[model samples]
Target: MGKATGFMDFKRQKGKEQPPLQRLKDFGEYTSRLEDEELSKQGARCMDCGTPFCHMGIEIRGMAAGCPIQNVIPEWNDLVYKGQWKEALQRLQMTNNFPEFTGRVCPAPCEGSCTLAISDPAVAIKSIERSIIDKGFENGWITARIPKTRSNYRVAVVGSGPAGLAAADQLNQQGHRVTVLERADRAGGLLMYGIPNMKLDKYIVKRRVDLLAEEGITFLLNTEVGKDITHAQLKETYDAIILCVGSTVQRVLHMEGSDAQGVIPAMDYLNGTTQSLLDGVTAPINTKNKHIIVIGGGDTGADCVATALRQGAKSVHQFGKHPALPKKRAADQPWPADPQVYKLDYAYEEAAAKFGSDPREYCIQTTKIVASSNGKLKELHTIQMDKITNDEGYIYFEEVPGTEKVWPVDFVFVAIGFDGVEQSIGEHFGVKVLNNRLYATMKNYETNTAGVFAAGDARRGQSLIVWAIREGREVAAQVHGFLEEKNIKALA
Candidate 1:
């Protein structure tokens, strides 16, 4: 609203990324922040629409259509346009505890729902948010503030990913004694290891974790809730327990030769490589001069392909079981929703630049993994899947008779998503595990066990980081209220 014709005058643009070829040489952040003036112009494209759907956060077609964190989008955009970065940061944080994290890895559903996107490209919300936070850091605006009052109510959080971090931060801010227990050697379960350093640097995660610690949120690393310390001990030690233990069990491809020597789960591969990077050593799953195949088509699978390329894989093939998306959004998938349009991820870009061909192969089904005589991975047998509509008008994939092919393979990374919350966690905590393999939490995020609650992927199954943070904040508010109502009857 600062400039009446701002949206008409300004164009949409995002920050620049390091060239695919040059960036593939190492694991580091690829995108660079724009200059303040350039970023302000990008912010000017918000237009101050009377009905801002950017922060509405409604779900369309079962997927999020806007910002899940309900970020005060237009307000901050106006602040950024006015060159008041500190005020913008304050507005951004009013609703979001960590705009910095969402600014980096989120898919930016907000952009999808932007009114401007219905006509032209959406406002540069992600880059603008990033610029504001980075400016806050540069000006020493972000700092740990000790709570003015201490309720002394002890709370134990059973993960340090986004959800656990958010819940812990909120509960600690309300003067509760918060302790986050992470089974990993470090905090940030998925953000630390599941995502590659190139997408989200571990130092950024560590910086926030360190800040939380400085603000008196104690983090117990390398401590497994069920193993190192029993569930009963944790319950006795803390007044409440919030289970943010994410859906960790990776889905397995139970195919022929699945037990081959070189096949590995996506998390195991991703986590090991990241830990090695942190330790200043070469990654263990060295792909130099090796043919790599990444199974599954989700972001994690895409990440596997990108990681292999960076590690000098001889060749890479990223396969998706389903058919390729349309170049343009389909009729059924219209504007304002997150349409599945055909797009190349950074991995495909790197592979195309390095090998002169895109790495992604669609409609692929791995029927078997051929093993060598020494019980190692030698080749992978695959079949092309064709979509067939049955007489009843139902569509499903069918194997084209005689379309089987075998290709030499050295490593296979299964990134087919998660099975559920780890069974051991539910069992140890004595929480009800639904048939769907996720924890059974009440509407308010409480499990059957008193003083025990679940949030994030543990309760909702595999979901976005923004959703996880929302769950974390909402659950913390509920838990704090529950603590206050010592003698009140709980809602059914």
Candidate 2:
């Protein structure tokens, strides 16, 4: 859709970021967008291949291969390249409900599977996307389009995360009276709390929530569904109930002295910091001048490292059970698959700039925690391990013989990931749950309850925000069809 040979003419360029050490002083977003000229060049790099897999939205070897929402990526890239920004925004919104959110936080599986990535660097699709939306906002071209007609249906959406917000937006646009229920004090569930402000500012979330409200969606905040109201009550009020309660059950460390006072869950640490920032109060847990250890080697672990660095941590280390990833795609991860490659993440860069070395300790496993005589955190005992692959294609960890070590640590943050959706929410709604996920068939998203449905992480287990958005859109269509077939009408 762009120039025929633009990929060859223009090399890939990326957005700018604040210097790592300098940005460590505050929690503001360090990244800045590229100017229009550069962004246009980036867009021009879209080769518009005959078989574009950038928007295929499929999975290979259990890894996302493209845009999960099936974004019309090449079309928007061409629009941006042609300087038709408003049209680009239109194309982006056609598939994605919240481009701003995904642009800021998504891993951009689309880029990973870009045809150009098979040879040269992929087009800067994520940066182009963020610029398009940001420009739309800056030009005041984006506004609320309140539905002109109101329907006789009411939809009560539980949870205000990405999935719930997407469903509410779709249903409200269809003229259904939609209400979003959030247990948190604010609307944007994980966006508002689970994520740190440095990555996604709370103002951005509030701005969108305000826009949604203008479009006739009601947000009931600081209200838990089971504790504040009953399922029967919701069914009596709304024509259909859609559960988007995200998978929030965090996993914890289980070992000797694992319950030490200074150990904390990764989400708790992130949420506390964000809430305190918004409320203008002290964070509940302080890391200033304290030696910190974070368990788990995922994005959450990196976030913990960054948070600790900003909070004036004396020293920081991240422990991961897995070995370091290869610099290039391995044999198992072929073309179009999201390659598990190694790169210095922002947190690692900042830590290295300040501490003179990377903070990650790969192939390490924590065995136990040692508490002081006063029952405070004292030391952490760990051992290094080697990765072993058996003939049956099974992988396992075998401990090294002489790598046992101990370090004096003051705090520990567990970032290993989540268990699943909170079971209590499902039990309250009378929905059957298996493997800690709400049991909804892929065919229709309908639960055992007649008028109730489930989607997003609650139904699919832990997943990316894009997947959640896709499910939200799909479930809204399903709910609309079900209501039409039943001929359900609001009673006066």
Candidate 3:
């Protein structure tokens, strides 16, 4: 503990955010960092529990309890409080490979699991984390770490997302030559396109990618493994291969008029917007002067709402099948478990500011899509739902009687979720797709094919960026071990 009574003395404080309406005018980061003195006080608030559940990195009741990458929270907090930012950054990098990305986008389950959160507000761990990394970069403390030695082993990493990048970083540090193959023109799969620029700037993603390249990790852009090259070629060329392709197949919303012209997937909308932004062109799917309807609820749905607001949508509404989360943590979500509490996310805040109210409609289910005579999406038909519990304790949603209503909508962005990795990639790599994810042994991250491994969303299903980074690090260790064992056998 930096100070024995620091937690009692200082209240948790967060960084300031740009006013919603003002921030919506441009695609830039909205949050501003606290000053050094305030940040030190925030760090001093760390109680530094003996158990330190903040970094246990475990799951409780199917929900994350703490930091998935197991960031050393207390030690870094102490270092930050003592004005040792360089030391804090070093402690942070001991586990997390990309704090910049996670600090911005991650939901911060670690804060929910903080020991201090049991009573008072949780430590502003996320803000402090972002500050440490940003300061490190500002001070030129963060740079490429080139390995002193080199191994003859060469590894090919598919997909340039968080997982693939982390795997490449780790493998390269182990003296292995690693090549990251990305289908997109730019690296950082989800970070580059799936997420909007306002949340995480492209410049931040590019800066890290450039640093990795400087450290000798080769990034092959616009070259897909199964298309530009074949699996057979990869097998012949690299000593080992790792698949980190993310879960990208969007879940379909089957309904009447599903083929309507204006119905699009959430990723499609986000990707198109980001690509056009980077290419200096107009996005094909513009929400300007349109009544936008976002189907489903979660971070993606929230993001869609925010994007539509920025695009000058005339009106916006988001639909969710689930009821609103309680303002306080429920009994089911106890201490040490990430609580499902209600609060306005960044998007909701923006929507409320622009539209006079929050645009989210919970406990509502879309039943059908109504199209015009020209087959263009005209409106959406939805019904209110009530939560029902059966005799066996199974829960389901039942449509409320006489609750059907029509919503005027110019476009519908389906943000339900993703199924898994694209099937063609799995088939080409000869990896079995079970439950919409690549079949890989959890113990070793090895797929059925020899010298081929899988990790990240492709193997674990859709998940957080922090989890993806953790899987990437673990898979690299396994790959290094497998290569070393093979080398010894060959010598024998």
Candidate 4:
């Protein structure tokens, strides 16, 4: 620990963000960076517990408990507290290949598992991490670590999201020639389109992409394998292929009038908006002057609400099938587990500031969508649901009688979570899908097909960016081992 009584001495400080109204005017990062002194003070709060559960990346009951990348949180925090920023950056990058991305967007499970968080606030790990990396970039300490020699092994990584990018970075460092193929016109997958620029600027994504290019990783944008390039060709050209294609298929509500013209998937809506902004064209899915309804209350749903509000929507409402969580951790949920507590996200705050009320409506189910004469969605018929548990460990919800209501809406965004990977990509590689409707994975993320593997949302279903990066690094290690074993066999 930096200071014996640091946790007691200093209060938890978070990064400041621009006012919601001002930030909505343009597409740029809103979070302001903490000053050097402030960051050091925050770093001093790290207790450096005896067990240090913050770095223990374990899964309990199917949920991640700590930092998935296993970042040396305390080590880096101590380094930062001592004013050794250069050393701190190096320590931060030892496990996380892309702290820049995770620092800004990751929910920071490390903080949740921090020992101090049992009673007091957790260490400002995420902010310290962001500061360390930003300092590295500003000081020119961050640079491409190009391989000195080539292994003469070629690897193909499909999808240029965090998982694919991490895999390519590791493979390139191991002296193997790595190529990334992205279906979109640009790389960064969800980073490029799914998330709004205000949260994670596209330029930041491009900055990292450019650095990877300099490190000898080949990025083939708009060249989708199995479509533009055949599976046979990929197998013949590369020694191994890693599929990082994320879960792009969005789930839908099979309610009445679901096929209306105004109904669209959340990814489609976000993609259209980002692409239009990138191309300097009028947004294709404009919510301007429209009453919008977003069905789902996850991050994607919040994103939809924020995007609509930014596009000058007359009004926006977000509906969630599940009831709202408690403001504090529930009695059953103890420390070291990610608590299901209610916290206002950026998008929700923006909506509330502008509209004078939170846009979210919890425990409401959409029974039917009402469409106008043109077959466009105009309103949503919904009913309140009561949660109840029955025998045999089954959970069910019942619609409350006489609680039906119609919400006026001109545009409807289905923000329900993804079902699984797109069928075309998986079918092309002959990947086996399990009962969960997600890609089947072995210990190292390898699929049934030889010389082929998978990772990220493609393998584990839709998840956090931190999980994607963890899988990416794990798959890279597996690929390296496979290649090494093959080389040894050839020599024998």
Which candidate achieves the best TM-score against the true structure? Answer: 3
TM-score of each: 0.97, 0.98, 0.99, 0.98
- Global lDDT of each candidate: 0.88, 0.91, 0.92, 0.90
Candidate 1 on 376-406: residue-level lDDT in tens? 9999999999988799999999888888999
In candidate 3, where is summed lDDT lowest over 10 consecutive residues? Answer: 433-442
The regions of model 1 sitting more than 4 angstroms off are 390-393, 487-492
Q: Residue 449 lDDT in model 3?
A: 81
lDDT for model 2, on a 0 to 1 scale?
Answer: 0.91
What number of clashing residue pairs does each candidate have, in the order they appear? 0, 0, 0, 0
Top-lDDT candidate index: 3
What TM-score number comes out for model 4?
0.98
Cα lDDT of model 2 by residue, 1-492, tens digit: 768888999999877899999999899998879988888899999998788899999999899998999999999999999999999999999999999999988888999999999989999998898898989999999999999999888999999999999999999999999999999999999999988888888999999999999999999998899999889899899989999998888999989998888999999999999999999999999899999999999998999999999999999999999999999989999989878899898899999999999999999989999999888999999999999999998999999989999999999999998887887888887888885554555489889888899888888887888999998999999998887776744322
Residue 357, candidate 3: alpha-carbon lDDT: 89
- Model 1 lDDT-worst window of ten: 483-492
TM-score of 3: 0.99
In model 3, which residue pairs have backbone atoms overlapping below 3 Å? Answer: none
Candidate ranking (lDDT, best to worst): 3, 2, 4, 1
Query: Any idea what lDDT model 1 has?
Result: 0.88
